[model samples]
Each structure stands twice: as structure tokens, then as C-alpha cells.
Target: MMTKLRKIILIPALTIVSLSGFFSCGVDRWPEYAHQTALDTWILDIMQQNYLWYQELPSYDDVNLFVEPASFLSKVKSKQDSYSFVDSVMATPLPTYGFDYSLVRNPDIDTAYNALITYVIPGSPAAQAGLERGDWIMKVDTSYISKKYETYLLQGTKAVELTLGEWKEVEIEDEEDGNEGGDGEDEGPTMEYRVVPIDEPVEMPAARIVEDNPVHKYEIIESPVKNIKVGYLMYNSFTAGTKAEPEKYNNELRSVSQKFKEAGVQAVILDLRYNEGGSMDCVQLLGTILTSADRLGEPMAYLEYNDKNTDKDATILFGTDREINLDLHSLIAITSGTTMGAPEMLIRSLFLEDVYPIATVGSSTKGQNVATEQFINEEFLWSVNPVVCTVYNSQHDTYGAISPATDLKVSETTIDGSTNYSEFLPFGTFDKDGKSERLLKIAIGVLDGTYPPKDDKTPEESATQTHFKVEKSVSSPASRRFSSKGLRL
Candidate 1:
């Protein structure tokens, strides 16, 4: 790789005078490795050109660039940056079982545990195998799962067969039924109810490279408010399709807008509770859809880069007449700790517009007010994602961990020997029993104020939120990347 090129210093006097070897002119004539691996050099060159905190980076000559590319990147990155990292070029979407899980101990056995499914990627192997967000894996292959073997759960490039289990309410005859052996004060046939696992084995195929459709689900829902409808969208990621077809997912978002327009929805429910983030273009485009038509062509958001890349700093505008724009009054975002980056940016952009109130339903979002650009070197088979710029709304306003109008902590788990089946419900407009998830129910309640099923207790009292207590996690690397890819441009 070093044989590929050369570096010409424009200012020889400066290089000779200053032993520091600082590129005062900041200009490189050609490809230069300078005793460093081509990968590491490329990483540094890209970071110098785009990193938002490039001024804080150590000089190229001062840093050890001969180390591994990932290590070199770590050494050079600014101390404030935590989202920037290096990975294989396949980080766009890696092969996987397509599900993330938490390891919980088995109540019956101290050593044994189960992998509780947290979220499954749509159209992935886990979803195809009839696995869901609330399912459990009691055993992997023939061995019962325990914390010791948790690292091997759904990992590597091999096929895995899992034994499934679910919590069910079962009746058991009580031994102490108030009967004193023929004294006979029997309280009928005493039975104790307990929620225990009904184990069933399931065969899961090997991992495969699966493309995720960030637009998980979209539909027009009849609102609890009389004669009004709401546009509901469950967006998982902000991905703009693959490198070859960048417009694929963006086009799908436009189609969603068209449907919402046709439905004449008065309010919108944007479900981004699981969305981690994606490209800036998708964020701007979706912002256009949610914003009132009058706000079109105005500044949606802008990027602030380091001093060296000020020329690259640009403001993203709302879509024009060519793009789909909704005339809705307000939007309710379903967000959680998983929601970050572009999704949060979109919410703030709309809120700053003041066209209408933008209310959030779930918990606060993951604070990521910065954007990253992926630098993929096909020859080196490496991709470097460095924080390139800070993102702000049109008003130059930005925040961390966007708070919700109605704060609710929601999660899923299966605790055997307990009676809690509420978390086992599916995520959709409505479950099999035609019931909305807690988040959705609360979002609707925020809009119409007729939620919580009109129970005797107040809406606040009736609305109970619970979270999963995860002792360990068996989350796949692919799942982590999907949710951790912050705002991208």
C-alpha cells in the first residue's frame, strides 16, 4: 500500500523551521502513507478533512500510526467523541439472526437462564423463524442456557437450534387446603395459580445478510377522538437503503407521506421508539412530511463542522413542492432511550418550527446531537465512521436526551412464577386482541384524553409502566450496529 504514492510539502521552509512537521498550508499533493499502514493513513486523512473536533486531534507525526487501523483511529479521535469508531466495510448490515436479547436467570434453576428477546429486525432470520420481541429461548441446541455460555448465544456464522418457552397461567392443587386429615374443613379443591413456562423447541437457521427496511410499518389509524384519524408510522432506523440504491428507503418514506396525505390525517403518530438513527437526507425528507406545507423551503436543520471544514457546513432545507408535505396540525413521536440522532433531530426541527406542538410519548431519547459520515475504503475493506458535525435546528437550538411530554418507562420480559403477561403483547397498531401497546395507548391518550379505557382511577393511576431487569445481554453485534449508528450524512 505504501508503494501507491507520494506526499509533496508545498511549504518546505515551514517544515524545515518547525520540527513539529505541522502541515501549515494543510495541503497534500498525493497519496502518502509515511511509514504508516495505508488504512491508518486513510483514516487520519479522512478525519482531518471531516471530523467535527479535528482541531483537537493530535498531529499525524505525534501519533503512532503503525498500529492496527482501529487502534490508530481510537488514538487520534477527540476525547469528546464517543460515537466515532472503525469497523469492517460490511458494517452497513452484517449477517445475523436479526434479534437482540437480554439474559435472565431461570427461576427454577439458579445456574440456568433464558435469553429474552428484546427486539427483532424485520424480515430477518429471527422474524422468519416465528420469533418475536417477547419470545424466550430456554435452551440453545440441547444445552440449557446459562450465564457461562451467554457469549456464544446467537453468535458466529453457524446455524443454531433453540428451545422456546413462554409464560402461561397454570393451576396447581394446593397441599395445605385447610384440611386436617379427616377433620375435613376443606375449602373445596384449593388451587394455586402461577405463570410458568410452557417449553417448546424451535429450529432456527444460520445467520444471513439481511437488509433492514427502516420503515417498519405505516398505516392510517382511527383515532380515539371522534371523526378524526391519525397517521401511525413505526420507523426503526434512518437508513437510506444500500450504497448501490440510496433512494430505495427514501422513496418508501415518500410513499408513506402520500398515503397520509390521502387519508387526510389530522394528527400524526411517529413511532421511533426503536429508531437509532440514519442519514441526514432522510431526516430532512421526513421533516418535510411532518411539517406543515407552509414551512416548505425553510431551514430545517444545519451542520456545524470544525474550523477546517467550515466550507462543508451547510443548512438542510425543508422539501419543496416536488416532495410530499403533510398539512397536519401536530405530531406525537413515540420515542425511548433507543431513539437517537436523525430521529431526534427531526423531532426538534419540527418543534422549533412552531407550526404545531410536537409531543413525545415514551421515555427520553439517547442524546446524540452530532452527525457522522461513513468513509468506506473498498480496497482496504474498512469503514471509518467519525463524528463529522454537530446538528442543530433552524433556530440554532440543540439538546441532549430529548424529554417526552408523557414520560413512561416501557420494556418487555418473561418472569416465570409471576403473573405479568402485560409485557408479552406484540407491537403494532393493535395486537391480536385489538389492543394497543402501552406507548401507543398513552400517545392516543395524550391526543384525545379518552385513554386508559375510562377506568375508575385517573389516567395516570391506570397507566402503569414496567421495565425488564436484565442480568446479562446476548445482543448480537449486528443489532448493536443497527441501533448505535448515530446521525449520518
Candidate 2:
């Protein structure tokens, strides 16, 4: 999944200084155009010929030609086009030198956003400075940060100071009910912050790991019916070996597959509940591992580009050469509205294969059957990620969202030390307590044929199912393992 704290750096500093002058550009090589109008012109030009939803794009005269690039993309973007988007790298680029935090509106402070240090990349400046997950970000520098300035705080730079804080809760009066314990108006609940001191700014190293240190965790449990063994894997993102960070993701996947094999699992529960897509290579590799051996070396899916680039379209294949294979006949997927990109692609592709059936249990899927390629100008100053193709399954089916076979929304839970703010269980901890997690319970029922009984679903059970009280704008592909499906210079 594209984390608020990425394992990779998508955008680097662009110091180019040109706009009107012609660029040494080709069909895909755009110039480092600096002016808003020229950049928009370039973006619109690219999208017009390349975007999968190019036909849906607004006319140049219909939208502002010189607004922020991100805003311009948003304005012309089709509501149906949920996956295609411009990252900050091409628009308002953020830095990566300091710690990474997922900032959300502070429920207590209207003006401030609560920050969580999701995870710290080891050996990075943030780790060297003693930063890690479960740390509350108290302040950026001098004051508590506002949501508007979140991008500014996360930019990649040579040096940036951070003020980490501790979590604290205070009591305040309950105004909605107009009632207090024994008094008319007393404190009920409030979140207060204690400032952290930063005497100086910290300098950072030259490079950062660009691909996701993918969060892959798996566990094994016995099925209630027939004593079948099942494997549960929580996959956060799909990534493969990159030149800069070779085997970072593929290796993790292989390792997890090995665990499932060693455990003698008869069935596998692929948990993509939070994954935003990543590398196509990694996605296909995992699919290969999940499918049976007879299906290998056969056409799995096809990638079709626009008419202009028929040469670029090609058939995807399933293979049997992986270190280990589950050889699963059917996969039980735990998904959510957040399930997207390659994850969606895998589900649809497997369903089309007919050999390896896919049964999903989660909320509605985030239909984003689009794949984007990152293009950088000859100067390497500006980059653009435009939709290039629409993925089709083995049956030549195209889609936006793939509804779950069984829609069971399971809310995340907080253990003793971990809070819902971050579902922390050390990735893949085997709960020796023999108690199944909420989602696992339902998936187990599905495996054992005990799901969907008349009384199986109740108001109390439905309440415990996963839900977000706060509204989140549907996440875009830019956040999913920010990557390209093609090779780049």
C-alpha cells in the first residue's frame, strides 16, 4: 500500500529554469517546463493522447490552464477515474529527509492535526534521530501543525527539525448531553500536548530507500471444520525488486510464501484489506505463487494501451518457477474499499482464470483498473504519472470496482499497547490465545461453511465490523506504492 510514509522517494529536487523555450521532448519525453501554463500544456498534451480516460478530459478552454498542476489534474479528472492522479513530485513536492507522519485532524484541537509516526526507515535520518512508529508528532518546529501545512512538513530536504510529543488525554465537559457527573458543567475529555524541545536542525544523508519496505505479515491457524490448516497474510503493498532497492518486496513475498508452505496450510486467506497497488511484477509474482502449478506458463491477463501504442500492449503470464508455491485451488481474500490497483487486478484476473477461484469478503472494492507510468523530462526536472492503459482479465473484462463476493466490513482492533490509530501487532504475530481476530473469524467461517447463516450477522456483529466515522476522500493511485509499470531512464 502507498503509505503516508513511503519506502521510496518518488520525486527529487527539480532545479530546471525554462518554460516557453522548446524542450528536447519526444512522444513521452517532456521538457522540464517550469511555468504553470507550459506545465499544464504538457500535462494536457500527455493526457490527451495517453490517459485511459482521455476522452473524458475537459477542453483546455474549459479549465484553468495555469493553476497548480495537482489542482488542474483534479479539475479535469473524471469522477469515474479514481486511480489516475498527479503526485506531489510533479506538483507541490514534499521532502523526505525528516520523519514521516500520517497527519489527521486532532479530534480535540480544531486547528491542529494529530500526527502518527507510522514507521521509520532504518538507517535513515529519522531512525538515526531515534524516531519510530507509535511516536506522537507533537509539533513540526515551533507550533502544532495544521492540516494545510502537512505537505510542507513532509518534504525531502537536506535538513528539517521535528518535535515529537507524548499522548495525553484530559477531561472536559460533555456539551451534547448537557450533563456532567454531579455538577452542571465540568471537564469531560480533552487531548492536550506537551511540547518537545529541539535545540538544533538535523542534516540528512544524500539518498533514501525509494521502494516500500513492504509490511508483509502472515499467521497459521486450524480451521474449525475438518481440521484444515489456513494461512492468513496481511499484505500492505505490492512491490518487486527495483534497481535501486533490489528484491526489497519480492523477497518479502517469497519469505511469506515459505512460511505458509512450511505450515502445511490447506487453504490460504490473502488479506489485502489495506493494500494500495504497487509493482506489476510483484503483483504477478504473488499471483503465480498463489495459483496451482498446472496454470503456470499460461496467459493470465493482457495489458492494452491506446491505439497509438499497440506495440506496448502485451500478455501477462503465470509461472511455476518461484521458490515456493501455495498451489492454492481457491483463494479467500479479505479486502476493503481501500483495496485497489494491482490487488484489484489480481482478484479480477484470478476470477477470470476460472482455474483458481477468488472469493472476497470485505467492503466495496475501490475499482481502479488503471495503470500509470511515470515519465520524466530529458532534464529530469519534472515528472508526470499519466494513465496509459486499462487492464483486462483473461476473459477480456474491464472494470472500475470489483464487489466483494461477501461484503463483511471488519473494523480494526487495538491490542493492549497498540491503538486503532495504528493497528500494531508486530506485522505477523501468532496469537497463541487460540482466539481468532474479527476478520479472521468470518473468513474462517467461510472456509468452514458456517458463514451467512440467518443469525450469523447481527446488529451487534455489524457494529463491530470495520468502519471509519471520519470521512476520507477516496485515496488515489499516487499514494499506492508510487511506481511505474515500465522502465525509465
> Which candidate tops lDDT?
1
Candidate 1 segments exceeding 4 Å error: 1-38, 91-93, 156-160, 170-195, 225-227, 406-421, 429-434, 451-468, 474-489
Flag regions of model 2 displaced more than 4 Å: 1-38, 53-68, 71-80, 87-211, 224-226, 352-355, 405-407, 413-437, 450-468, 471-481, 485-489
Model 2 scores what on Cα lDDT? 0.62
Point to the candidate with the largest TM-score. 1
TM-score of each: 0.79, 0.65
Cα lDDT tens digits, model 2, 173-263, are: 4357545465656344553232233344343353344323554457787876668888888777776655566677688778878988888
Q: What is the lDDT of residue 238 in candidate 2?
A: 76
Count of clashing pairs, candidate 1: 0
Candidate 1 versus the native: TM-score? 0.79
